[model samples]
Target chain A: MKRLTRMQIPYRVWMFLFIVIPTLILFVLALTNMNLYQIGAFDLTLDHFAIFSKNEIGIAFWNSFFYSSITTLICFLIGYPVAYYLSTLPNKTRKILVSLMIVPLWSNMLLRIVAWEKVFTADSYFTDLTGISLNLIGTQTAVVIGLVAMYLPFMIFPIFSVLEKMDRSLHEASKDLGATDFQTFVRVTFPLSSSGVISGVIMTMLPAMTSFVLPARLGLGTISLIGNVIESKFMKEVLGSSGMSINEGAVLSLFIMVLSVAAFMMITRVDKEGETLI
Target chain B: MKKRLWKTRAWKALGIVLMSITFLFLYTPIIVILTLSVNSSKRAYSFEQFTLQWYVDVFRDPSITGPIVNTISIAILSTIISTIVGTLFAIGIHSLQKKSRIRMMILNNVPVVNPDIVTGISLMIIFSLLSFTLGFTTVLFAHIFFSIPYVILNVMPRLKRLDPNMYEAALDLGCSRYEAMLKVILPNISTGIIAGGLMAFTMSIDDFVITYFTSGNEYMNVSTWLYAVLGRGQSFTPAAYAYNAMIFAITIAIILFINLKKEKKGKLA
Candidate 1:
């Protein structure tokens, strides 16, 4: 390791203060009654946990989980074939297609959601054509759609990476043994791509679970996912009359953190188990 | 044999259909926004005619213009800062031993995988506690914070691929440490730096959640501006559509330019 110089000290201090300190503050706030106006000078309290346990919080958490799970499933169903097809294409064509998949990702996320809003709103062509209006704008379906659009590339890239690296000889051998193409894929290709599938699932699931913007925008202000609930508690009206206490917000944030950590652990465990089985 | 050939062709046709539908689903909303931006009708969805009036309106309107300028400025500045800092971190981390490298990698992954909302609120709370006003500076900082990890992730992989012997050879020739780094190390890693910078700039421009929390009432970014306008239940104007189309067009142009440059270089080599 390079020895630290005087010039490096200031940069190190800046990182510690900005990145490391903020994370530490998050941990501390998760445990205490750090109110909006007061900052609660070291007063430890578990009252916030009570608020987090309420039906509203539980329901929001469940809804977030439910939506993310459905989004993951949909992405897997849609992305798998596209990934397999892309893998079979010549390299140059595959690159162009993959680039198209990523182009939407480069645009502003909020604008992307707004584009969907324009698509599903009452005046949209879908509504115009069907005449029976589907209220997708402020529903759970909108959230799921937004999530699928946002995370599709994440799913595709991982699956593509695995598929691209897969040995074609294995598929040929499976076919040569008198198995049909479908049988070859089911028995050989799908199992080999499980790592990529796991990766895509994790990538899609984590972001979808924690997404605040899409839901807040498309799901309307009243629709509270875990993320929306946390944001509302922290920034919207924590000190006001209608606002819950700061401790309550902290507890909710803590719950989210716990859930995320557990999910991470579960993913890692799955990866390890998959590796052993393979 | 004829039946098998027919079945295979049918399967291929099915594959194409499935792929096309997926692509349509992914891109239709964006395509709608682009088409509607040029539509002459006052109504949001009606496609009676087409015009460039919305593009004119977007340019002429100060409210829209200001946010667009702010978003660009923030993105450019954050890209510059993050590229420099992230490159340095990548260098520093690369210099570490194996165990510490793993630790650094884990530390870096936190920002990438952490929920944007969580990072935003945490930064918001910290900035408020420190008495920093949530405005331009806060927005810039938030962007830099999020962008650094991406830059580092992109750059570090290239750095790992770099051969250490080049530095040793430079030192053996009696070159100064600074010269060795500037002449030998920087050139080899330039592509990684450029890729990282592009990614960082794109992320900074595209970010909404963190920008929302850190940006105070004093200023509005393009994303925030769009959000506010959409929330007010205003009719979709052609100008708004043109502005969005412009964003999409710029993205396509940039990607094309980059890919073309890479292809030309490959051909030359």
Candidate 2:
């Protein structure tokens, strides 16, 4: 006990109080039939898991997964080339580009989504200017575009940093071996910087799967992603819904948690360090 | 060889074009928001004339002030607390022998790896268990809670890059562990600490998920305020448009400040 590092004590205490116990609370709340109104009335039941059967919940789950996956895929396709290009630029240009990408995150993201919402509306800014009805609002395309716009920076920076610091010697050696530029990229550069790619995907996908703001605003409150489902469960009790389904909310929470941790583990198996998470 | 040179040139042009489009896409939404804020008329999408009426309206609105105050205050407060505790935890976790270090790492990973929704509700459950009402205090704790792991993640790598021998050398020179850490280790990792604090600030400022669940209806941050208006199924007030403009202005100021400071540091090194 005396040998415990002094610094670890305070943090350990914090972890137990904030982290460990709360996790227990998640399982306990989910596994039990605890209603929101009567916190006291508790029964151990798996009824919360029954949300999986409802087609709406299932569709929402699938929608969240699909949107996030597509968002991630699109980000990579666009972001990788940008990152790769930035990596090849001079230091000053690279720094400017990278910082330019990141600075948007500090501003209000909701406002940005709201801006997209307006642009996609029936009388869009585009339509107002050009007098054409694109009619994109409330569409999946709007949600996807909103998400991709918001999350692209997150995807770019990690890959850029990784590629910037890559071993130039390896690339030179591959070229010396008579490898073409495309071959060198495919065999050497992509494989080496995959850690960054993995980190980018994980970062983008997690928030993408869990974001309610993009779906709600961009979809005009019509889309029902899993995040919207979870949010509605919480948002409804306050907005005048009976029986908050706090237990069912917990069930969905646990499900998301399980999916996320599994994704992390699977990603980590390929990339143990995943050093570019930020 | 000429053909190959032309081909490479073409590819470079294509990549640049794609990159430009990406940058354009990234910048366009925020630019539109900022441009729309100063419109002469609220309903008019065109720039028929410019007006600061929205700005005046935002300055006069009572609800805007509370949310602005709450958002900035929460961001600053949580950044301070999380940076301190998270830096110490990074040091402590790094100092430990292997077995317990792995355990601590896994625990530290929870807040990072867990979806914000899970973290929010779980924290919600605990706060409820402790009979703490959902309000400013719970929101503070929630922000601090999530921000710490972020700080830890940022600082841990810096700590890992430090040479263990430096600490031993300080101890051999008769310094206490605390003193050695302060004099030798802290200087090396201050950059990481600063970066982590910046990230924490950025995250806390932008946060809506955890803050939404944990903050009672009364304690409104910038995000929750915006969300509340959106939830009512109405577009933002013209005043809210002005507020978004202010946020963009602050973001630009921050970017310039960080860049100048980084340049100064680079020159020094």
Maximum-TM-score candidate: 2
Task: Tell me the tens digit of each residue's lDDT in model 2 across A1-278.
Answer: 12325776788888798877877777887888665545776788887788899999988988998999999999999989888888888888877777787766665777777777667777666555546555688999989988888888888888887898898999999999999988999999999888888878887899899998789777877888888888777667435654647767778887888888887785556644445666
Can you tell me which runs of candidate 2 are displaced by over 4 Å? A1-4, A126-133, A237-244, A270-274, B43-48, B56-59, B174-177
Please give the distance, in angstroms, between residue B61's alpha carbon in candidate 1 and its true position after superposition.
Answer: 0.6
For B1-269, candidate 2 gives per-residue lDDT tens digits of 99899987887787798788777768767776676777766664555567888888776778777887898899999999999989988888887876777667767777776778878877887887888889989999999999988888889889889987888888889988778888998999998999899889988988988999899778999889988987787666666667877876877787788889989998999
Give a tens-digit lDDT track for model 1, residues B1-269.
99899987886677677678677767866776776777777765556676888889888878778887899999999999989988877777777776666556555655665677767877787788888889999999989988887887777767778887787788889978778778987888998899889889988888788888889877788887776677676643456667777877888898799889989999999
List residue ranges in candidate 1 displaced over 4 A.
A1-19, A40-42, A123-135, A167-192, A220-222, A242-245, A263-278, B1-14, B41-45, B232-238
Which candidate number would show the highest lDDT if scored against the true structure? 2
What lDDT, from 0 to 1, does candidate 2 have?
0.81
TM-score of predicted model 1?
A: 0.88
In model 2, chain B matches the true chain B with a TM-score of 0.89
lDDT of each: 0.75, 0.81
